[model samples]
Target: MAGDNVDGVSTRESLKSALKEIVDRTASVELSGYRDSAEMSGIPESSSKLAAQETSGISGQSDKELKPSPLSGTEMASTTATSSKSKSKSSTATTQQSITSRVETPSDADVRLSSAISGLQDYFRKPCFVHSRLDDAVDVSSVITAMSPDNFSHLSHSSLVRTATGVRELAKRIGQATIKVNLRSILIVTKARDNSLIRLTRELARWLILTRKVNVYVDAKLRLSKRFDADHLLDPSDHELDSCLRFWTPELTSMMPDLFDLVLTLGGDGTVLYTSWLFQHIVPPILAFSLGSLGFLTNFPFQDYEKTLNRVFDDGINVNLRMRFTCTIYKDGHQTETFEVINEIVIDRGPSPWISMLELYGNGHLLTVVQADGLILSTPTGSTAYSLSAGGSLVHPEIPAISVTPICPHTLSFRPMLLPDSMLLKVCVPRGARNTAWASFDGRHRVELRSNDYVTVTASQYPFPTVTASTMDYIESVSRTLKWNVREQQKPFSEDSDGSTTPVNDDEGADDDQLDDDWDIDDSAFFSSSSSSTALSGFNSAPQSAVTTGSSSPLHRDFLTLDGK
Candidate 1:
């Protein structure tokens, strides 16, 4: 690897030297043209031969053919002087006549001087591609001379008549070209709870701005109050923060995802989830640095941030297109509000004594009706989140599927099911339900769903493109996080000096799937898109079995429950 790097550096140095040589040659030719033209202009008109010879030497072109010479200044001057002195009187007369016919309206010296100036202007205006070999190298003047204006005629079809509009369009293209080299913007989101994470964010931001000239955007509140605040309070520095960096608060963060080229999240999986939620519509790619426990989504570590960012900047990494769901609440007919979900949307019995009843409709067809603690409609990207705890399947983020899992469903037959992303889901609260069901989108946008109110779930048009670390992918993340297929250390068969093996414990590793009992506190609150009742008449129809509430006894259900019998 060291040898390869050395070779690469050597090749780059060679290329740089070759390019510098080409540029120096071009500059010299331009400077030489100015000097020769100035010298020729001062000479008397009688010395037309000297003027012609000097002009030829500077322009690097012969009079007969406009073919530029690659000879050095001294060589060109010697060659021109020798040719001029060696020519016979008859040859000189023929040359002067040939020059006269070419410049019929003007003298040979004036025409040649004008041509030389025009050649310099053309060389300066055009772009040049330098060859690696010095022998095959051609200067700017030669390239422009060999190139025919007619060859680029197609570039300005409307300029055939030289119209005012064409001139304006050409000016616009030139202005665009001048501004086309844009510097990319990067947004940094760090975990505020940890001082180390905040410090890392500041260092990363400073490095990006100072080294890459990239614009960095951070939460203004965090920058003002947290790390920045602590820096001033504790160990003060002589240097101030970069003035070029833009600070944005939570209110302004809504505009950030679109303005920035990429997002760098330094924290745990929750930080990435939060960033994903911030971009409710279009989400730029994210580079997540893991600095917290259980970093399923935060693939890269803070220690490897430099290498990880290098890969991202060089576009040497791939992005996983994680699916998100666009959920809307229809109160009557019109949509109340719409929000996006990177994780599961939980519709649960919030602070209610009775279980929440929900009727699920898939693509206008009744899929199921269940009385449960809640219902979770999760995108494949969210399968490993709360949905997993609710007994939902772990789906790969790349899969175009959605999981519907019921939280403590009363019916034993109600199992989590995966459906195609194209399927539209409508979860409605039936009339005379025990209580209003509350819905939350990715643990936010909590709204109360009364009788006849429904919320629709569909795949969002925009997918979140997340960058992963070299260490883990989706499958590895699941294995690492959930400890999937992990087994306990089993004791091999052993005889206690009796030629008999002790009874093996069949219950060993039985609790491998058991999850931590730590209850997740519901601190976040949000609502999905909601509409009015009149707009929801289309979904009022439900399956007969779904509409009926079975009796308390598992076997003795009332068939005529709709009649309240």
Candidate 2:
């Protein structure tokens, strides 16, 4: 046993010495190769020094025992030289085996190489992929070249150039107008299981204080119980509460007016909606930070808080103006109450009544009498919300349009319709209507509507502000967010390709089974291209059409213009 122990110690020492020599030789070879390559490529010699420094830092305490395995030393050295020769080839394909082997080996060299590869991957993947059309290219020579031109009118340019210049000018104006006015207070409202957001909020508050941008006011529920004193000991709970209140709410007379210029919400879309509803009348522009699960509205990433805030303060990024709808409920033909809706306004039967019978009218013309569970009146901004779920078209935000979608109507012919924004919409329950209906705004704030009540809705004067990084068009946002027809590779049958056309399939002749059965009848009755003679009856005929034209169909024209206000 004594002899065996002595032999093991000697072998270990010999291996250690061999590894030290191999490491020294490898380092010398790598340094020389790196220098030669840098000189050949005309790269600065200082870069080699920096790389060496970084490599040394990564090699750390292993410097003393920096050695290669005895069995693999010769093979590894030969492979390393071959790899250097093939460095101009595809790095990924050539380096895979080496990377896997190194990862398996327990050494600082392996860890350093893995870290460098990861850093390279991160650098290559930093920018997002954007798709643009050929006609959308803008000449940004003045901006890119750092030339201070007074106006874009002086330059000869195309329509794309003109649009880019307009955006630049608008950004400049926003920058000039938006000053970092000292905020009187700030409120960070959140719900349960949000410790991560709570910590991030505290850090953001500290950042704001350090920059002297805004005076923050946190909710009383989140205040720390104790304070640190001169001796590094905590003060009494009463003293801490007093100090916190002094900063949060100074005056005792009334709750401090929401003098905050921005309400930075840190939660899901539900949280944003709640905050908007809480201060709907007095709320300022919101900069929502996404910390919850689904973030359709709260888009600002929590990790990039600093960059986002800087852009808001300095660059004046684009803010998407979202429109809201205001609905007034009238009981017995008099305006009784009003509600604001950011998403949509719904008129439906609640738990107390049976299904509803709603009579919808546009500009005093009876469009349809619906027997359904509910009806949704929404602006283009709200089209993507409940309206989409109820089978309405997804209208662009900039388009001046409104959607009327019925929810589970009894008649299959009742389909969603888009109307011009200028039209006034009314939903009323007739005196002999079956059930009582309730009107709600954004799924909250309900008001009971009796058989003799009506709800009228229209576009409101107020618009919500949403901040974005770029001035991409509305269609671009939809395409990216909704993943609509985004192809990973170009197809040969694309419009730009000059390929032979393929033969049509026999299956293409089949009728579309997805169409509703009642749609054909409805189309023939309401939207026939040819004009036909018809009597003008007011909601009395079973199959009479409501649409009319003048001079050609006298009876239809008279019925359409009967009740002119």
Q: What is candidate 2's lDDT per residue for 274-370, written digit by digit as tens?
A: 6656544324456778777646676778789888886766654455556667688899889988765677899888875577888888888888887
What TM-score does prediction 2 earn? 0.49
Model 1, range 47-115, lDDT digits (tens) per residue?
A: 333334444443454433221232333433444445665774556666565544444344443345444
What C-alpha lDDT do the candidate models reach, one value each?
0.62, 0.55
Which of the numbered candidates is closest to the native, going by highest lDDT?
A: 1
Q: How far is candidate 1 from the true structure (C-alpha RMSD, Å)?
A: 26.5
The candidate scoring highest on TM-score is: 1
| Model 2 CA deviation exceeding 4 Å by range | 1-187, 191-193, 224-258, 352-354, 363-365, 473-482, 486-565
TM-score of each: 0.53, 0.49
